[model samples]
Target: MPFASQPVRRVAAAEGIRASGHWPHTIPAVRQLLTDGLDLDPGVTFLVGENGAGKSTLVEAIAIAFGMSPEGGSTGARLTTRESESPLSRDLTLTRGAGSARWGFFLRAETMHGYYTYLEQNPGMRPDPQFHELSHGEGFLELLRSRFDSPGLYCLDEPESALSFSSSLALVGVLNELTAGGAQVLCATHSPVVCSLPGAAILEVGEWGIRRTTWEDLELVQNWKAYLQTPERYLRHVL
Candidate 1:
């Protein structure tokens, strides 16, 4: 049977996020990625692109508009309002059928500290004493394992940042289980492991615009995969 695209159940933000005159505003031309009149595929949608490709930016804007915080989206990060002044704006009157009955996880890099505090604040949470309390990568995986359980919409930015070869596979396993059980997962990543979900749709956000492609078509993932798959060849070329 042929595959069908996941229909966007709901879209939280249709435009770019708001920014003050300084920090958020000075970064780049974000408001230009306004995703008006667009919809996400229903089950699992992957935002595949490079760091500054604006994939995360657009996701962050919609997430914030959906009541999430900024890109460093930690609860500790001061929750702010939309970018009413910024040229980029999200205009979404979510259809009750899609976004109304949903739970979500929006995990970004800069705001990981908020999640750290979240775990620490729990009654059972404990403060870490080791310099390697968890390797930076380990901590990132731990966050994924700990936070991603309930059924809802989840958007992740570079979840591969924390995983080793083995751990990346483990994270992929978690995502597979989650999607198999009916949760919606969206991730922006360089790890082929995480993007290996059986039926994931990859949207490549680039200088031009969004393009749907296969996971292997992603340069970062393919390059890394090639290096890992044939280290001696890469090593020989390197020397």
Candidate 2:
């Protein structure tokens, strides 16, 4: 695809930064990202990994680097509650596509509540979704329906947290619509259903860092398959 079509084309560490033994730097995925830049596809790109594998970290850094609020919202949002974000955004560099839409939004599952409250406090010209009055999953879908209309970079961190199986399917449909409209999406997710969006590039993050893989080949998919086929087979070990 043309460089002008996507929002962020690449992500790498800023020049003159050396990898260290810091918390995030020590993570293999972060180290690899700093050493070798990651190229994003024009449409949707899903980062899938086990918990603590740095997928969320990468998504958060990319969103912040692209000028979205750390707590979640559009580039213009100033939502801030706890300052627990890492310093990786400061060291990371995002290569913006020429003539692409500069606007973007970050839907961070953990902080959407705060972002909704922020929106209420700073009401804009647009009508509020009244997120506080809706259920968690309803609020998420409402936010997406309201804000995901524009063509820009949409970064989501574990957005399926509040969604059910059918709701996950709805999210996938929304994502398809977004990409079809020239939007770019970077999502960090553990849900097999959500990441199953057709044509989405899946990157597996693990001890080996990052590697492109197919949906059928994803560990997440295989594990879910096995667990569903015979839950006793896997649950025996944990139980």
Candidate 3:
């Protein structure tokens, strides 16, 4: 059945993050991180930032408030959370445009060995060749190719966790095709290729908060590419 047509959900987070003070009290660069909420089209929206910039905090709050799970992580393990049975459940004064929204996550699965034990719980539901049964990169692609569905919002945190260069490009193509068909995708990633999914809106989290940036302007991508293309100049001094 086709999903019900609903008013697209709007996340209006300009700054000021708190969970009644459950999370780390001091969120660095809070204002600079999300000075304005990006209007996520009915397509891919990529969140890019350095470590400890509060990107995950924003997404985790949304997931919790909506009673949805962040895609990755194990059942027993813990992410920063308040005392709650479902970490993905919370009460926030959200100013939403209006709509029925659901959330899921696309965290990179752990190492192959860990993934095997993880998958052992889902014998029937596991992907072919199995997630644990394939190389880290292949397993990730297969899981995405098989499991990701449409007409819902999905959050992926740094999916470049396992992909090689070739697979990374392929993953980009897949994200493009998914959002073009009317689904909403919100991803937190450092991969330039993953972040540049054509129509994706790039949000950079820094000392202030979250600001919209063009795909070409991200310094990490530029520098990383430069290093990869010519390593000797950068590496010669270190060695």
Q: Pick by TM-score: which candidate is best?
A: 2
Off by over 4 Å in 3: 1-8, 12-25, 28-39, 70-106, 110-129
RMSD of each: 6.3, 1.1, 5.5
Measured on C-alpha atoms, candidate 1 has an lDDT of 0.60
TM-score of 1: 0.69
The global C-alpha lDDT for each of the candidates, from Candidate 1 onward, is 0.60, 0.93, 0.59
Candidate 3, residues 1-239: lDDT per residue as tens digits? Answer: 12333223555432454333333324543332233333444567777788887666655555444445343433222243333332322333334334544434435333334444545555544344555557777878877776565555565667788899888898888788777665567777878878877767787876756667888898778888889999998999899
Best by lDDT: 2
> Which model, 2 or 3, shows the larger lDDT?
2
Task: Compose the digit string of candidate 1's lDDT tens values, residues 134-236.
Answer: 7787777766666677666567777777678898888778877777766766677866777777777787766656677887787767888788888998898
Q: After superposition, how far is residue 180 of candidate 3 from its true place, in Å?
A: 1.6
Tell me the tens digit of each residue's lDDT in model 2 across 133-210. Answer: 999999999998899999999999999999999999999999999999999999999999999998999999999999
Candidate 2 has what TM-score?
A: 0.98
Ranking by lDDT: 2, 1, 3
Stretches off by above 4 angstroms in model 2 are 1-4
Q: For model 2, how big is the CA root-mean-square deviation?
A: 1.1
Give the clash count for each candidate: 13, 0, 13
